[model samples]
Structures are given as C-alpha cells and as structure tokens.
Target: MAAASIMPPHTNPPPPATARDPTATVSDPQRHRDAPTPSLRALFLRAVDPSRPSSWSTAVADLLSSGDPVAALAAFAAALRANPAALRPALPPALRAAAAATSLSAGRQLHLLALRSGLFPSDAYSASALLHMYYHCSRPLDARRAFDEIPAPNPVIVTAMASGCVRNNLVYTALSIFRSMVASDSAGVVDEAAALVALSASARVPDRGITGGIHALVSKIGLDGHTGLANTMLDAYAKGGGHDLGAARKLFDMMERDVVSWNTMIALYAQNGLSTEALGLYSKMLIVGGGVRCNAVTLSAVLLACAHAGAIQAGKRIHNQVVRMGLEDNVYVGTSVVDMYSKCGKVEMAWKAFQKIKGKNILSWSAMIAGYGMHGYGQEALHVFTDMRKSGLKPNYITFISVLAACSHAGLLNEGRYWYNTMKTEFGIEPGVEHYGCMVDLLGHAGCLDEAYDLIKEMKAKPDAALWGALLSACRIYKNVELAKISAERLFELDATNSGYYVLLSNIYAEAGRWKDVERTRVLVKTRGIEKPPGYSSVELKGKIHLFYVGDKSHPQYKEIYAYLEKLLERIQEAGYVPNTGSVLHDLDVEERESMLRIHSEKLAVAFALMNSVQGSVIHVIKNLRVCTDCHAAIKIITKLTGREIIVRDIKRFHHFKDGLCSCGDYW
Candidate 1:
C-alpha cells in the first residue's frame, strides 16, 4: 500500500517506497538486499544533505546522469520531505528528472508541490522546466496551461514554450509564439537560439511564406550569416513545401559554408532529384569550402547523390573516404554505401557494404530490400526481409513498401498480394499511398486490370491521383484503352494540374488509333496552360555533368557527339534495328518521326559517353522520364553491336543492357 500510494495515482514502481525514516531514500527491497553497503544514502551523503535541498537536487541530477536514476529520484524525494520551503529550488531539477523518466504523474505532483508552496507561477525557472517536462511526457496542453500561468515570461520561458510546442506537433502554436516574439522583441528574445526554433517549426508546416518571412526577420537581425542559424534555414527551405533550390543555392553561395551548410545544400539537391547538382556541390564543399571536414551526414548525403546520379565513380571515391575515416562500419555511412551501390546497378558492392555494418537498423534493411527490388531481384529481397524479421526487428511501413515493390518489379504477383495482406492483417501496418501504388503497379503489370480497379474501389482509404496514375502507366504498356480512360478520368478529378497524366492518356490514345482524342488532350494542355517538365538525360564525366535534351546542341562537343550518334544509328540500322516512330506522338510523316527519334535525349547522352569513355567501360545514363519502347530496342541493339554495357536508370528502375539482353527481362 505504501509503495502504491507513493505515487499520486498512476506511476510505475512507486517512488522508492516512502521509507519509515522519511529520509530513507531507498526502496525496502533494495534496503533488505543491500543494506549497510553503499546504499543510495551513502552515495547521497558524499555530495548532499536532505535538509540542504540544492545540493540534494544536485546529487539527484548527478545520479540520473550517471545511470542511477532510481537513486537520484530517491534523493529528490528525501530533499522534498526535509524542507517544503526548498521546493522552489528543487522544482526545476525534479521536473527535469520527471521528464527524463517520462513520468507524467511525478511531474504533475511536482507541479502541485510547487503550487502548494505558493512558489510557482512567478518562478520562471520552474515554469520553463514544467513546460519541458510536460512535453517530454506528451502532455502539450498541460504545458500550455502551465505557460499561461506565468505572469511575466522571459526569453528562456518563451524559447522553451516555442520548442515544446514544435516538438509536440503543435507547430502552428509554435509559429504563433514565434510571431509574437518577433512582433514584440522588447526583451530581444528573437536571438539565434529562438530563431532556430522558429525555423524548425516552419520546416514542419511546409509553408514557404512563413519560412521566407522568418528568413527575412533573421537577416534583419544580422543573424543570417551565423553558420548554425543558416543551416536551420537551409533545412527549412529544403523541407518547407516547394523546394526553391535556386534560392537555397544562392543562400549557400553567399554564406561562409561550413560542413553543415554544405551537407544541407547537398541534401536539398538530392531531395529535389537534382543528383548531378548534389554531386557537384559535394566536390566544391571539399575543395573550396575552406577545409570543412566531412562528417557522417556529409558523406551519407553525397553518397545518396551518387546513387541517384549513377556516378559510381563518385560513389567509390566517397566510399574510399568512408574507409579512410574509419567509418566503414557506421550504420549511417554503411547504409548509404549500400544504397548507393544498390541503385547504381552494383548489387554485389551493396551486399558487401551491407554485410560490414555492425548493427543494422530498419533503414539499413529497407535500403537493401529496395535495392534488390530496383534490380528486379524479388526472391533475394524476400530472403533479406526474412532475415530482418529473424534479427528481432519488426518490419515498418517502409519495409513493407520495399517488399511489395520488389515483388512487383519481379512479377511475383502472389507474393505481392500475400505480403500486402500480411502487412495489414498480421503486422497491422496499414498500406499507405506508396504501398497501394506498388500494388496497383504490380496488378497492372500482370494485366490484372479489373482486379487492380476492384482493389482501388475497395480500399478503406481513398486513392490519390498517383495511385490511379500508376494504373494508367500500366495501361500504356498493355494498351488497355478503356481502363486507361477510366484511370485518366480519376486522375483529372484528383490532380488535374499534372501534365504527365494528360501526356500519358494522349500516348495511350495515339497507340490505339484514337488520333482525335490525342489531339483534344494535346489542345487541353495549351488551353489550361499546363507546363510539362522537359525530358533530359544527364551523364557524369570527369567530375562534371553533361545534360542532353532532345536534339540538345548546347554542349561544346555537340558536333562530335552528333557525328558519333549518326554512325551508331547507321550501324544499328544495318544490324536489323528499326525505329519505332509511333513513340513520337506527333502527327508527322514517318520520315520526320524516325528523324526525331534518332536524336532522343538518352541516345545523345549514350553517344557522348561512348565517344568519351574508354572502350567497353559501362556507360551510365540517367533519364528524367521512362525509356520509350524505341530507345529500349535501340539500346539493346547498340549494346550487342558495340559490346559495351549501357546502364540506363529511368524513373521506374534500372535497365542494364548487355549482349542485347536487359536485366529487367524487357518487362520495363
């Protein structure tokens, strides 16, 4: 009863059992088991006395930090019992201990203890601590009530309130507080620390307006040049809604770049699918960044850029750095290497990197799964997933998405369906839009259009446009015009602004001889002012990126690239290769279509790589869109004729063309 009653109502283990001596500060079981032998009191006596509350609280803090929280809490209780008037001085440390222990009941009682002593509302130190404790215990509303009780909040209290609000997902409340601080900075609480908190809040809300205004305010206060503050703002821009990468880059160029500044910019470029730009920045960060040393985050971000850009050479360079820095076994660095190699069409390198990681986390497991999925190795991915489960780790939402995608890419329809159901029914991990998109893609790839449609209709959550768009893409592959129209109709209702859907539908129509529908769809683009993103291919060479659009001639070496491409085209044609002019989607004569197809972006990039690279070296080309049927056929023939392996990483997956056969088995 004493142990149960030691807590106010509901807390575990019961607060050191409230010993008979009132300053016992040791549980009965602990006392019985280890009496007279360095008891908590013996440790407490060296540094503190119960009647001296400050030192006693100091002992509590030291105990907690030294991995003896039970003893620390006991000492805290002993001090409280010895002197009620000392509660004011003791409250902050007690509140912090409560936060560390995540004990809501203990924190609530400390709030009561402060209130009973008539020492709270005005005690700014205790008030700030109470805000922290409440948030740590997942009680934001209580924190707000406590904050409102403070008659004159100071800078520390304001910072704690804003930070707590942000941490608790009350981001708008945090923003409002930040705005209030900005509007009335009589105390000048909008210091670098507080500004960092505000930037973090803006990052969560994804509102560019708020982020820009805060950036301006931070600049007006002359804190813009502060490296740490600048890093926070950079992160806000990257995560905050529309990633204005140009603005982030300009900010980066202006600031005296630190490792964090460089890392943030690199991550921003990677997040926005600007992998080539990311790799370039990583190079600049090392050479020209005033000798800013690369940390795990820095190398990890650059490795991700290398993965997406298929700059295996750059990736290998970073990998060598990882080895040199003795970070070969760091989970973060190792996982990035695994992910980098996996996406760059080097599965063996990925596995070696994965095996070297000492302690694998969910992210590491998921990366390997997605890597196998990318390479169309479904069975291998499942085996890795099984190993992950056996290692006492549970699969999360990302893990299941990777699993389903692996199955889909490998055409393991039954495995995909079973895993989809297993995720929901057994693991209780609800399938998100990405998971559902994987399922739709899988069914569509298998020509189970009706079943995919039925699955969408039966989903508990409403499908987004991307889900329907996945079906539409599958429709393009199979030329299922009726289902394509249905998916397109849903896509229009859900995401009418997306130009890709309209283009996809138009392509489907053109394939089915529905020229009228294709023309109408193309006209709608002009009427609605839809801007389609231009298709381009980029290949990295000698630490620089060369990008090509359809018939791009901006490169200084375009004359040579064009000549090489013409020769390759003539050779491929001689070897029984015929261009599929239907992919053009233009109502041009056959000759014109064939002529346009000859200069497609990937072909130009390939021609450039072939001209520049050593003979028989693998040419890695990254495209912004799907590889058309004609290019696919052309690349296959080119691979055979030249005896060169060409790896084209498109939007969906990797296509490793070697000896006239692709790794995707022509499924993609």
Candidate 2:
C-alpha cells in the first residue's frame, strides 16, 4: 500500500482494468473521488521555490490573476513567508486586485501584511487600496481603521472614506470626516469631488445648518458653476423635508438649465401643491427649446401636476406624448399616467393604462386601485386587489389604505372590517393612523358611530385632526348635533385656525336649531381672524383652464354663463328638483337661500361646461372644497335633464352624476 503505487503519476491516468478489478485489491473509487483537494497554501508552496526569488513574484502574479482573491491571498502569504523583499513590491497590486474583486477576507490579510512590513502608514497607495477594499465590501469600520492609519491622507483617500461613511448611513460620521479634512491642511485643499460627497452626506442628515454651510463653502470655493453640485444642492432644499421651495427655486433659476434642472423644479412645484405653476414652468421649458428633451422624469412630474390640477385634456396630451416617446412601459411614468387619469375622473383610462404597463410593480397596482376607489368603483377596486394577489404581488400598507378607502366610499362595511383585520392578522401590517381613519369613516358613514368611537378609543396611535374631522363630517351628514359638537371641540384644539371647522360647527348648530350657538361660533371665527377660503371650481376645456369662484362674474363670458345657468336651473326645477335651502347655513329667507345656491362654484362651472363643450361629452370639474348638498343634488338632476355625464372631483373624492343618480348613491 505505498502511496506512489496507489496514486498515478501527474502525466498518467489510472488504468481502466485496475478500476474494474476487485480481486486486484482496487482502491475504493468513491473514497478516491471524495479525497480532499490541496489547500491554497499547499498549492502556493508547490508553485514557488524559496531559493528562486523570481519564482516568488511569478507565483504571486499567477495566483492573483486566477480571478479568485481568496486563493491569491494564500499565495501572497506563502510568497511573503518565502521572500518578504520580493513580495513587498507585489503586495500593493495584490491589494488592488482584491479590492477590484471585492474580497474582504483577502483584503484583510493583505492589509495585515502591509502593516507588519511597515508599508502601510508610509505607503499612501497601499493604504488607499486597502481602504477602497473595505469600502466596496461595505465594512465602514475597517475602511475607517485603514483611513486613520494613513499618516498623511490625501484628498482622494478622504473622499473615499467620507463616501463609504455616507453609503453605510453614517452621514454624521461622514460630515465629521469632511470637516476634519477641511480643518487640517494635510490634504492641502478639498476639491469639488470631496465637496460633492459632503453635500450628499449633509442632504441625508438634512441638517439645515450643515446644508447652508456647505452651500456657502461651495460658493466660496467657486464650485457653484459645477452643474451636478448645484443640482444636488437644489434637491437638498426641495426634498430635505424642510421644503424651502423659495430657496430651491432661486437656486434653480441661477443655474444654466439642463433637463435635470427642469425636472427638479417641476417636481418641487408638483409636490408642494403648486400644480398651476408647475404646468406653467413645464410649458416654459418646452418653449425655451434649448434642446432639452423631456425624459421619463419630466413626463412623470408634469403628469402629476395635471392630475392635481384636474387638467384632463392636458393629461391626455401628455399621455399621447408618453406613448410617442415609448415611455408608457416605464413603471414610474405609467403609474403617474394612471394617477392623473384617475384623479381627473377618468378611471376607465386609468385601468387601460394600468393594463398597458409591461411589468406592473406595487405602485402601478396601487395607483389603479386608488383610482377606482376615488371614483366610487369599490367593487372594481376589490377585483383589482384580488388580481394583484393572484399575480403573487404582496400588497403594502399604502395598497390597503386605498382598498379600505374604497370600501368606505362604497359603504362596504363588512369588507372594510374584514380587510382591517386581515391587514394585522394575515399581512402583519400594523394599521397606521390613516388606516384607522378610513375605518372610522367607514363606520360613521354606515351610521355605526358608537362602533367608530370604540375603535378610535382602542387605537394604538393618537388620532390626528383629520381623523376627528372625518367623524365630525359624518355627524354633519347624519345630523348628530351632540357628537358633532364633541368632534368639533377636539378638532378646534388640534387646528384652531382652520375656518372650515368653524363653518362646519356653525352648520351643525343651525341643523340642530341652536341659533345662539351658531352666532357664537360665527363670532369665534371672526375673533380668531379665520377667514374661510373661497371655494373655486375649475374645468379644463380646449386645453385652457376656466376657474369659477362663488358668484364669480369676472370672466368676459360671465353674462352668457349666468344666463345659461338661469335657464338650466329652470329646466332642473321643472324636473321636480327642490333646492336644499338647509345647505345655505344662513339666516336668509327662502328666496335668498335659493339665489345663493344657484350661483355656487360647481353650478357655475357646470353651466360653463354645458355651454362650451359639445353635447354628450363627459364634463370633468375639480372643486377646491367639498361639494355642497344643494349643488350635489342639483348636479344629479342636471345630468339627467341634459343627458350628459358629469364627473366632479372635490377635495374628498370623485362624484359621478348620470341619469338622476350619483355613483355614491346619495351617501356621499
């Protein structure tokens, strides 16, 4: 059983007859096949001869070039043991290779070798290579250890360490490193690249003081002309949660415009509810025509603006443009398109766009569900959710919010409660305030006020003003004066300056025949300097937005609009429509109440839409506030009389009036 007899020579294979001959005392094939392979250390020693200095370098190079840093480091260790002098020159290259390959263990070993050989602190290149290796491996502490060992770190090393800290969510640490670099002249001067990294870190921390300081430093260093840095600063101001839009715009205007600059400004405006200004700036960007083509980002931002502004025609044009640019398949742009169409009262178009999306993500599905929910298509929303689950996509918290909201709007109480429990039990998503708010709204709408109150009491999180306001609105609808008063008291404490709450409380008093209380609430409103914001309705026709305020007579066609509205009112009244004078909430006579209801913004906007747009066309109107009871009733009658479908989107949700009925079935 000699070892050389059992094993064949390097150049020869074992004989086939020996494999088949059990009588010849053949070695077990399975045992031979299961034998342990040579270790990297053994392989390295076999490749190099200690007496040959050239052999050490050649063996290290071959191992390093094997595309496996682990094996390469073992060869490097053996070479170092054989001849440290010969391997010293190759250690830096080995470290660099390990860094490129993202070999953390190999890099650590090489790092130790450099430190032991006294080549670390004195050799900036080797130290930088080790720092880079640790950064790529996402080991910030190791990167810092290597960085601190550098006796005189240069700008490149400082930037690398700071970036590593930022990438690892150590923004404060990165900023400290950057400040230290600035304080010490060891790195001579911090360049724009380092400043960019510092600005990025500052943005993540969103420290206003740090961001302003970085801005000053960037200007003082004359790096303000750098477009990329300026763009990053602009994003910091706009999206850093502070929302310093004025500063963001100023910075944006000062920069020489690029596609990114336009996109950032458009997104900032859209996010801050300045839809008109956002669309205006988008138009300006197109008009300036500096060869700045609209990309997916631009289209998404502008589409969102159109959605907010209820510019259906404008949104449709953008949709056509998206198709032309072949960006309809992009998840973000497709999601925005669906949102715009849905918010603009085009749920059918939203569904079509959702289907066109190549690979639908969570946002895409959620947008469609939200669209259907907003339009009071609750059953359709539930169907989409079922399809989403079947497609193997797990719904997130936002998706459940939309589903629960759909249920609330459609009076699907049982479904709403079932999903509310399922969110916690099945998906393990603890309900947030928004989810609880929707549940409260659902119960309140269904006349289960006591149950809603009990649920609120059981809430883990404190209810916000909006949640209280939902309960108060329900009280108003159901004429529960006592609960309305209680809800209003809580709402007042949370938001005393909101005039709508005071007006709502006054209306509740009037509904309950509490005249003195109504007067007292009105006096409180005046004393608090809470002026009710005027409600306006806007309809986009022929790509131009026409706005109508309460009793608005400023438009050049106001006379015609009023005349047309008077005639339309006569027709709706003849169809057995009685004005809901109770909604006036004033001490005026019956005649005055009817007159006030006639000139409501939604009524005026509807009249204008009838006179301007073609017959049988779906009229889309957006109101700044909720639609009043009188206007809501009147629109239903008008739609039946004129044989036109009217879709009105208010602050709350969509109302579709067709053939004397609304999608909400008179519940909303």
Candidate 3:
C-alpha cells in the first residue's frame, strides 16, 4: 500500500522509453525476482540515470539470441509492461532482433506490448522503434503509420517510411518523400544521407534526377565519405536509371574498398546491359577479395551476364558452384538459372530447373513464361500461365507482356484480347507502350490489319515505333501499299533513324511494281546513308551453330556446300517446285535472279542443315530477315518431298512447315 502511494499517477507519468542509453540493457532475472514493486516515476528516474534498467531485458535478449525466442519475447513483454517508459527501447530492439533470429511471435509480442503500454504516441523514439518493429515483422502499413506519427521525424523515420512504401510497390510515394527531403536540404542530419541512399535503391527510372540530387546533397554535406552511406548511394545509382557509372566508379575508387563496394559496381555493370564489363569487374573482385563473400545477389548478377553473352559454359560452371556452395535453391539464383538456360536456347533445361524449385516466386514464373514464349511454344506458355494462376500467384506486368507476346506469335487473337483486357479490368494494370505493341502485333499477325490500325490510332497513349512497325509489317504482308505508305510515313515521323521502315516501304513499292517509287526510296536510303542490317541465317547441327549470309562462301566446305545445295535444288525442282523469285527486289536478269534466290541465306542454311542430319530429321532454321517468297516456297517443297518438318523463325513470325503447309497458312 505504501509503495502504491509512492508511484506517480498515469496522467503525468514519466517520458516513454527510447531516449535512454542504448547500452542500458535489462539483462537478468534475479533482480526482477527480488526487487520491490517500484512506481513508474521511480522506474523512469532510475532508467534515466543510464544504468542498466533491469537484468531481465538482457536475459530475454540472451534467450532470443540463443534461438529461444518464445521465452525471450514473453520475458521482454513482461519487463516492458512493468515500466514501459523505462523498458520499451531496450525491449523492442531486442525483441526485433529476436524475431529476425527466430520468431515472428516474439516480434508480435513486442509490438502488442508497445500498443498496450500507451507509450507509442507520447515518445518519438518509441514510435520510431515501433515503426522498425512493424517493418521487421512484415507489417509495412503498421510501420508506415508508426513512422508518420513520429512528432518531429528524423532521417531514420523517413528512411523507414520510404522503405515501407517501396516494399509495397508504392514507388511514387517513396520518390515524393525523397524529393521533399532533398528540397529542404536535410543533409545536415546524419541519417538524412542514409535515407536518401535507401530511397534511391527503390526509385523508378524517371526519378534518376532526384537520385542524383540526393547524391549531390550527400557530397555537398560531406557525408559521401561514410562507407555505409556510400554503399547505399551506389545501390541507389544502380537502381535509378540513367546513372553515370563514371561517377559510381569515381566514388568507389576514392572510398576505402570493401566487398560491398566491389559487388555494387559489378551488379551495376551487369544490370545496365554492360555484361562484358560486369565480367571484367567480377574478375577484379576475385583478385581483390577481402572477406567479401559471393552472396546470392552477386552470383545472380554474374549469371545474368552469362545469359546476355550466351556463355553457356560459364553459366554451367557457376551453376555447379552454386550447388557446391549450397545456394542452388535460393529463389533469386533459381530464377537466374531459368533465365540463363532459356536465353541459351535450352528450353528443356530451363523447365527442369523450374520444376526443381520448391517454391516458385513471381520472378521464376515470369522467367519460365518468357522462356516458353521465346521458344515459340505459345500453347505451353499459356499452360504455364494458367498453372501460375491456379497456384494463386498473381501475374505482374512482365508476366502479362510475355503471355501477350506468346498470343501474338501463336495468333491467339481472342486470348490476346482477353489478357489485354484482363490486365486492365482484373489486375488494374494500365497498358503501357509495350503492351499496346503486343496487342497491335497480335491483331496484325491475325490478318486484322484494319482493326490493328484502328487500335493504334485509338490508343490513349502515343504510339511508338513498335506499334507503327507492327502495322507497317501487316501492310507488307497484305500488299496494302496505300496503308504501307501511310504507316511508313508515320513511323519515319516518330523515329527518323529507323532504316528498316524505309527498307520495308521500298520493298513494298517493288512488290507493287512501282519503279519510280522504288528508285525514289533507294535515293532516300542513299541520301540518309541508312544501311540495312544484313540478313543472316543460322542452322544447328550436333549442337553447333553454323551461320550463313545471302552470298556467304566462308564455310570450309564451300564447294561441297554449293554442290549439295545444287543437287537439292534439282531434286526439289524435279518434285514440281518452280522458284518464285519475285521477292528479289534487286534488278537482275531472270537466270541471275533465280540464282540469287537459290543461294539466299535461308536456302543455303536449310540445304546444309538438311544434308547434315538424318534423312527424316526435322530442320530448324532461324533467319534474321523475313523469309522471302522463293525461300518459303522452296521450304514447303522440301518439307513435302522429304517428309520432314522445317521450322523457320524469321523476323516477322514463326513458320512451322510440315507436309506442304505452314502455320501462317501462306498468309505472311
């Protein structure tokens, strides 16, 4: 009764915790067991002295550190409730560390205790800790509110808020906060640099200016020398597009090098399409290793480099290393494996790796979908997407993009429209330029040229080269020179440097027998010096890729290759194949024209691939340009006479020829 009388009332109690010494850890059980029941004021006064508040807090932390988070969390909550103002700071951090180490239940207990203690509103420090508490517990909204409620927020609170928004995909919100902080020149605050650094890591592509401003602020405030803040700046620069790697390199060079510094540079190079540079940096990282472990992120970066370079051997070695290092099942690593294999044209290997993943994340799903789509396995891609949905995984914009591309390739017009609408109606994903391009390509490939043109014209967003290019391509196939000219003019207006558009228009004029227009187009090409990309054809034999061009005689077996091609031509012609040489736009005599068509890259590659394989084996050819009419006719005859499937993936679409018919049904 006397002790109760000595305690202060709830109305004017002591300040809530978190302002006390970070080192005042409550670390035992005996004191709590034997102590008198002190008043809140007494507890506050005693805690404010900076001595260890209670041994119980430390004991709980020890329990948490030892992986007995249940007990540690329970003990921490009990101690915190005893005198919240005196115990919250010590308990929340310990509880959060405990939660990260072992149990979310421990985190939950600490959070609930904070809420129940009625100290969260009164103490800014406590609120900040609570914000971090919720963040660590994966309750980002709660963390956001806690951060917002901080009376006069610091950089720590601002950083936490930005991180929370980004984790939830509120990229714009994070960007605004970062902009505000920069505008106010909050660089004087020590944590402001850290906040700017953190926000930069999640900033969108357009926010590169903001990110650079933050970096400038960091430099102006003289905090660029801080290693942690510098590393954060490095990550931000990499994530924020349009960053100058020169700046990143300069900062990295001036800083005392750490593993993180090296890793960030390597990742930046890999992410920004400089795969060769990434590999070079990785070599440097290897020579300069200083206890910097090769983390999953680093490994994933190098793996992507392998994908871009098509370095299958290097990727395989990395895969083995990943397994040996016991990181094979890491989701990020698994996703990278799928991507590498897919890009290397090992679709089956990608599928096998995908199946082995215990829990497939959205990235993994997107990678697989992309693999199937790229391999021209449209039906398989659709099936994978269906499976993804059945597994309760929501498809992101990338996923839809892949699926829509598959539909475009397979000419699944209805399915394409369904998904195009679904992304907007069901998923609330606004269609971007890429998405609109896919839709236009879908309708265009389906021979709905009018509808495709209308879609482009009615697009809420402005059309890009891809959209106009699709319509122009459709015109070429449909022999609609009027539409072709209109689309070509629009395309040139939008992108004056696209030589392909001019070349396509010239070809269309040739097809329409407009000699003057063809000459005019050639003159324009000459004046602009727009060099058309040389057409290339590739054939795979015994897993080796053999390449050829229209007049390529580089093969070691050039004589034999020509002899074999001539014999094949005689046989196919004998089988009633008349060379359709009209697609040859070059002015030449009839015999010379026929000769050129015979030696066209696709014909050369196909003839070689056919001769190298078994009699009935299917031949798969990839061509850099659209298959010419003569080549398509020759392939149809070859497939019919030899009874072999000849799958040709040209620039426009896949041509799957079996028996005398193609998937495009002679339309394209």
Candidate 4:
C-alpha cells in the first residue's frame, strides 16, 4: 500500500535559522541562508546518477512499493535515462508490478523500454508479463503481437499466452496455439495448466470434438487424476450441448467429489431438464457426510431443479437452507430462488425473494419481472420494469424479452407494441427471435392474425418454428382454418419430426367440421411416423413428485384418488358445470368424449393432490402441454367448489384458479 516514490533523506535540506541579536547586531553580523530544496524529479535524477553511486534498483523498488504503477514506471524511466545498463536488469520486475496493478498504459511504456533495451521477447519472463498486461487491458491483438515476438518459447511462456487468449475470449486462437504445442514433442509435454486452459476454451466454444480430443490427451498424459483438471473436463462435456451426459457422468463418477464437482453435475442435470435426477443427486450430496458442503452454487442449481420439476416443497426447503446458510443475499442464489418460486407457480414467494436481494443487478431485476410475466401479472411486470429503469439499471435484451412476454400474456397489445418499438429506438437492442415471437404471440392472442403473418414476413431474421407455432395457436383460437393450415405447413417443414403441429392442424380442422381434412392430417402424421408424446402432469408433495398421465392408474393410492375424483365430478355437475366434449377433437360420441375429458392428465394430478395434500394448501400441477379449454374451465369450477387455490403451470404461462376465476382472466 506504499506510494511509488519516497524522497531521499537530505535531498531537500531545511532552511537555516538566523540568530537574533540586540540593537547593535545589524552592524555586527550577517546570517547565511540554506539553498532551496530540490524538486522530486531532481532528487530522483540524483538517485540514478552513476557518479553518485546510487542504487537505481532501490529507487525503482521504493517507487513500486508506493503501489502506483504509473509513478513506478516514471522512476524506472528516469533510472533508465541516467544509467541504462544498471536499470535494464530491473525492467522485468517493474513490468510485472505494472501488470499486477492492471495499469495497461504504464505497462505498455515499460514494454517499450524493454524493447528498446533488447530485453523483451528474448526475455521469456518479460514477454509473458507483457502478454498478461495486454490481456488485462482487453487488447488481445497486442497480446498476440507480444506472443509472436517470442523466439522458441518455453512451455511456461506458451501456457501463459494460451491462458491469456482464453481469458480474452480468443478461444479459437488459444486452441490453435494449444494444438501446435501438443504437436511439438520438443516443446515438452502439454502440462496440466495448458490442458485445463484448452478444455475451458473448448467448452466456451462448445466444440465437443475438441473437448473429446482434450479429454483423450489428458488421459494419455495421466493428468486426468488431477482433481481440478477432471472437474474442468466434466464441465466441458456437460456444457458442450452434446447428448453425452454419459461421458460427463462417467468423468464425474471417477473424480474425487468436490463442492464444485457436485455443483457442476447438479447444474448440468437441471439445465438438461433432468430435474428429478438433479434433486436426487442433491439429496445424495446432503446424506453423504464429508468436506463437500453445499454453497451458493449448489443451492442455486438445486433450486432450479425444483422449479423445473414443480417440486414446491423441496424448493421451500432449499430456500430455508439458503436463509440458514446466509446465502440468500448472494445475487446468483437470490435470482435462482426468485426464478424457482416463479416457475413453480409461487409468484408471491418469488416477489418476496426478489425484495430481499441486496444490490440487485439487471439479472435479478429481469428475473423478478419475468416471474411476474410468467404468472400473468403483466401490469406488475411492467411496473417492475419501470422501477428497474428508475433505479438506473438499463434494460438489456433479456429484460425487454421478459417485459414483452408479460404484455403478451396479459393481452397488453398497445404496451407490447410500444415497448417493442422503444426497445430498438431508445434502448438500441435489435429485436431477436424471442422478442419477435413474443410480439407475434401478443398479436395472435389479440386476433390480429394477418398482422402477425405480415410481421413474420417482415422479420429481419428468418422466422423459426416457434413463431409459426404461435401463429397456428392463434389461428386455432380464432377458428381460422385457412391460416392455421398455412402456419402448420411452415412449422412442419422446419420441424417435421414433431407430431404436435400435425395434431394442432387436425384440431383446427375438426373445430371447423372438416372431417376429411382431419383424416388426411392423421394419415400424414402416420405416414411420417411421428408419434405425439403423451401428456403428463406432476404434483410434488412431501418432497416427492407424483406424475399422472391421461387415464393413468399406476399410483399406489389410485383407487382412493379415482373415487374422490368421481365424487368431486358429481358435485361439480350438481354445481351446474357441464363437460365441454369439444376439447376431445375426436369422432367419438359425446358421452365417450366427455369420459376422455374426465381423465385428462391435469385433472388426475389435481385429484391426487387433493387426496394427499393437507386441506387449505395450494395445489400446484405442472403439465407437459397447454391446458385444454375444457380443463381450464373445469379447474375454475373445481377451485370454486373446493374453496382452495389451484395453480397449474403448463408449457406456456401459469393459471391460478380461485373462486371460478383465473389469473389469466380466461384469455390464456
């Protein structure tokens, strides 16, 4: 913490005192005065003077100790001017100190000095320091230039350059250098540090082929046993977006489990939609006693798993643990908690968690806004967006996506359009596919089918399947068979293997009473061998998720659940609720269609939840598909009759039913 300079003792002498005399002193004596003190630059020059035999090393060291890289460089420059040969040996240390301070301009000046003295590039340590300084300053090109100047660089120098490239996001260049190093046996075997850096770059680039190659190299070099290297490789495989979970798991299983290892695996599972496995691994981690305790990362990953699986009870328990560990204030953990509660249909809890997050950044604010949007609280989402701007957090691309989605869900067409325009004109964020999709959905939901189609046509980027799907969905809602067919054709061409689009088209046909077209669509689906995945719903109770598919009777308590559902159905009928058989989209008789509607997955899950959960507790169900119109209406009646809040999170947004009303206001 010392300053980079200290004035030499006696360099600036104090003024001499004049002796006072009696009335006759003026004629008797005259006083001599000391010379004026020298400036700091003059003292520094004197310290560097060769004739005076001063140590420029001592002066440079004292200047470095001042903790100011700029001042240190100035002293070093002065020393070099006075006695170039004496200070040439001290250039590397001065450059290193400047690099450490991240003073790029000063470091560059020292680098120039090294170059002038012919001590750079030929001097491996100096070259590495310059490379590091360039990386710190985000000057990758300069770093590359420094690296290229090295003649026959050693492994340490090569590793430093490669690591710098990775740190500067020059992954392809890093990989190239790494490959050259590996190919040169004369350059020495690739060390653990180089391999780790290569693997990190591979993961960021998401080159699974390179990742595999690195893995093989590591294994061949016997560095696989190193715990940190193994963890990095595991992360590489997990995040490479390849379907090689087996490889990631194998590596994870073989490694000595650290807190990071566990977190990596849990986060991988959560990200890949294997939420059940994620929660199970979390449980295993808790049960196994060791030095590996859960940290903010572990809690965040597991909370994401809870959100995905709709494991509310488990999420609550994890939230309590977050509080106990005092990690609730950690931004990532806090954001995860908000996202978890929001996705799990607990908007109130999500808001509470959002409120407690100190130093909320754009990500935290976006999470809260998205949580409100997902729960169909469009106005609240917009209000939060306003507050975020007022708090001086600029809305990024992701923030705008969330805001537009909220407007879409709440049928705020004008608000959606205004923001969509403002996002580009004011915020300078070009509308990406997600923003376009939200806008299409907003328009489609508002019955502006032609406008939605025109917008798709005018998109800067090619419209993707999701955009077409939104249009098709809108067509179905408004019973526009012609547009629905057009949308379905585009969607099917893009994603031909997905049977859901075909089913949607058939549904649209059936709604229009075009039996022949429905038959043709069914034949096309069969011809393509595309099977629609069966829908299922899950309800988490007592930290365990219970799944129920349509017509499912596999649960241990299925009989009780069925009997309760039957009685509840009768009561709902008595309460003047009639079955809407049109949702079946089949040629069966009305009675048979009604029977099918009764066994819908969501209803089954709701029945089981009611049978097992305590009275007055909220029922949360996660569905694999969008809720049907019949189910939506039925749930409203069920909530009114049972006098309990029921939250159903389908593929789209949430539906919170209480007293014959839903949060989506019957629009979604």
Better of 2 and 3 by TM-score: 2
Q: Residues 266-328, candidate 2: write the lDDT tens digits.
A: 998998878888888888898883899889999999999999989998899999999999988
TM-score of each: 0.87, 0.75, 0.60, 0.80
Measured by C-alpha RMSD in angstroms, how accurate is candidate 4?
9.8
**Candidate 1: TM-score?**
0.87
Displacement of residue 422 (Cα, Å) in model 2 is 0.9
Question: Which portions of model 4 miss their true places by more than 4 Å?
Answer: 1-114, 129-149, 164-180, 186-188, 202-220, 559-598
lDDT of prediction 1? 0.81
RMSD of 1: 5.3
What is the C-alpha lDDT profile of model 3 across 1-668, one tens digit per residue? 11112122132332456433443333433224223222222233334333344544555455545444444444444444454443645655554554354345545555555566665666555566566666656677766766656678876667666665665666777767766666666445445545553445444555555556776766776766677777767776656666667767777777876767777888888778676677777767776765666777878888897666545556777777778877777888989988987765567888987887768999899899877876667889999999999999999888898898888777788989999998999999988888888888888877788888888888888999878988888888889888888888888888877666776777788888987888787676667766546677877566445788876788877778888888888999999889765543553222234444337889888878777888876677768778877889888988888899887777655677899878776755
Candidate lDDT scores, in order, read 0.81, 0.79, 0.69, 0.80
lDDT of 3 at 428: 95
Residue-wise C-alpha lDDT for candidate 4, range 508-614, written one tens digit per residue = 88879998988888777667877556788999988889999877778898888888888988888888788765642543222224444348789889999988889
> How many steric overlaps are in each model, in order?
0, 0, 7, 4
Model 3 whole-model lDDT (C-alpha atoms) = 0.69
Instruction: Identify the candidate with maximal lDDT.
Output: 1
Which segments of model 3 are wrong by more than 4 Å? Answer: 1-243, 246-256, 287-291, 421-430, 515-668
Better of 1 and 3 by lDDT: 1
Clashes by residue pair, model 1? none
Worst 10 residues of 1 by lDDT: 1-10
What does the lDDT read for residue 354 in candidate 1? 96
